[model samples]
Target: MSTSRMPLALRALRTLLWILAVFGAVGLALGLVGLAVMTEEEVVRETGVGRSASMAALLPGFALVLVEAYLAATLIRGGRARRWCVRVLAVLTLLSGLLGLLFLDVAGLFEVAVAVLLLALHESRSAREWYRSGTETGKPDGAVPAPTG
Candidate 1:
């Protein structure tokens, strides 16, 4: 079975993922700029670390942004790899969100909500079917059908 059109939920999820990708990219660029403009003294004072250590401390954030960008690309392209990536991302998001909530951080709670939504989207029947079939064929289930006479 195939869908003639992308389900509304899937479309919305894809759009959200793309938006997240853009957000991550912007954050990464801003972070790089901030790091570049900060004085060594300021970095040391803020992080209580030497210049090199402070730069190294930024690695996790950079990695997260890179993962977000990759997730967006995989989601947009749609394949077996996307299924695994989404699962991993969802788990990471959930763990981060839970940790945030434990520390009484509002942002963590928000992240938790987003993680739940992402999980829901991924586990939806349509999404599951689509992934199963689409990955096998290396084409989305919602591909436009060729018109027949």
Candidate 2:
């Protein structure tokens, strides 16, 4: 928790989390819509067969979206728990992306794009150094140890 790094790191984490949350919201919305189509007789009657099937297939994407949002929020808090959430979200994102592509869902492509951008932000040079050195390991480069006094 270096004083200087705290502000910047928190800001970066917040931005990344918010971005993931937005994507998750979209997925959740889509999932709810799909569920409606799957269960409602009126929806089927109105939209017909193909659209209903398409909606049904989108359920998993929506579910994954909620999970991603939770993980992103956890990431901001920064703990062992948060780290685990990140891993889960990463895997779910990959799985959903694959499913979306296979089913020709455009939302899957959108998820892929956002996930890539967030990953780039998280893996930026500064972020990595902060993660590796700031937490529990080496001191910042060029930092001199204090005199024994």
Candidate 3:
């Protein structure tokens, strides 16, 4: 199918993923800069947090950004693997949100929102049709109806 005819759900999901990837990248860059410019002693003095704790916190976020970037690419290209990736990523995101909640962090709300949006888009009728069509062709909505005899 032409890009113009693509499902709205797929388009929304792709857009959301890209937005998340960009934000995560920006956050990671800022984090790296903060780390570079500040000493462990300074961090402890300023925020009562250790440098090791900050580094540990960023690692999972960095991993999440990598996953979001990969998922965005897979969603565009469309394959059976993309379906699996969506499911797995959604589950992981949900788990992350739950962990955040356990820690009483407001950031958990964002993670939960991302997971809900991801699942909702994947499960929409239009997106499912789009994925089914793509799976048949192993290409991004490339399945075409047979010509009339």
Candidate 4:
């Protein structure tokens, strides 16, 4: 995109994304371990389902980890795809936070805060301009220069 230096806010967002990704990774690992160690009866008791159904419960956590990792990499590389990914992540985070609140999980409130911050940054004029700067037009700033004689 614009070969120019990345904005400070974007840099900060990237760092935050990396941190979130790491957290997701750890959560995923722990979830997998818990699943592995759970006895069939324990799984049924906890989920009110069979072993297969209990294992399916971890899929969402795995997906979250994958999405976080992809977002971090895209942000790091300054990929054109990052804009869309950030938007998706922000919405997903907000939804997750809402769900958490509904379930009375305190941690969901924190995710909601993070989602708000991300949405604010992404919607800012600077971030919009940055995302717009790099596009299929192949011109920096997407401006058509005046033709010279």
Candidate 5:
């Protein structure tokens, strides 16, 4: 990705991804703390799930959240592959969010919204051409090239 004249979609996606990562991490931490504070019997009585089971359930989410953070970090550098990375990650996020819904997680809605926005932004014409141009010039499609000496 060109540092200069980066597409608004990319900029927004990158920022949003990082924000999602932060929120996910915070949520996970809170969940863990809540679990830790609860007695095993209380956990079973309250949620019909054991503490260990709940901890196990959180592992995949933590992994995926880390991946989201990684994707955001990747966007900070120059690469042709970042566009495809964003697309694939966005789909994963959407599916993950849908899976979260099955567990009655309200946070899933935020995940879905961000994923949908990421899809729309990255799929925009300007963003596509920006990736396609593959030049450091930072001009997306047909902008006039600087006259070389």
Candidate 6:
């Protein structure tokens, strides 16, 4: 949180998350539109894809925006909820990537990969700084220090 110790990548990731959330919302709206306006037969014929499969594919991104919103909210609150939110997002991103890969959809996979990589980078860098400060200076950032004999 210190201005001096801030990493550029973390800022960039935060910006990316905002952009991603907007796109995710759009994707969600499009999926809802497809569901409302198109028949199953028309969807399959127009996209060469099944309606069920298309909806399934879009659902994760839509759900992730909600997840990301939760994370953003809880992250600011700073408690167990924040930790859980980060872990959930990480796991979801990995799972989304894997699912896309299994379906042979590179676009979906790429979106997931970008999300995961940015989050992973931010977390790892933050953890590294935490570890260094704890080991070298005998203090942790934001977290309660363990009792030592």
- Candidate numbers sorted by lDDT from highest down: 3, 5, 4, 1, 6, 2
Tens digit per residue, CA lDDT, model 5, 26-71: 9999999999999999988977899999899999879878887987
Weakest 10 consecutive residues of candidate 6 by summed lDDT: 131-140
Counted clashes in each candidate structure: 0, 0, 0, 0, 1, 0
**Which residue runs of candidate 5 sit more than 4 Å off their true CA positions?**
1-4, 78-81, 99-108, 135-149
- Name the candidate, 2 or 5, with the larger TM-score value: 5
Scored by CA lDDT, what does every candidate get? 0.71, 0.58, 0.81, 0.75, 0.79, 0.62
Give the Cα-based TM-score of candidate 6 against the true structure: 0.61
So what's the TM-score on candidate 4? Answer: 0.78
TM-score of each: 0.74, 0.54, 0.78, 0.78, 0.75, 0.61
lDDT of 2 at 94: 63
Candidate 5 has a TM-score of: 0.75
Model 5 lowest lDDT segment of ten: 133-142
lDDT of 6 by residue, 24-134 (tens): 798799777977699988988887888888778776666789777655433322334454566667677777778888899887677677757766755776644633342
lDDT (tens digit, per residue) of candidate 4 on 13-33: 777788887987887688668
Please identify which of the two predictions, 1 or 2, would achieve the higher TM-score against the true structure.
1
Winner on TM-score (1 vs 4): 4
Q: Which ten residues in a row have the lowest lDDT in candidate 2?
A: 133-142
Comparison by lDDT, 2 against 3, better one: 3
Off by over 4 Å in 4: 76-80, 135-149
lDDT of 2 by residue, 51-143 (tens): 557576666656655665665454433445555565556556666677898999987887576556555655567655555443431234345
Residue lDDT tens for model 3, 1-149? 33424578877988888889999999999998898799889988876889888778799889889988988866766667877888888889899898999999999998998999999998899887777665333245555556779
Clashing residue pairs for model 3: none
Q: Give lDDT: candidate 6, residue 126.
A: 66
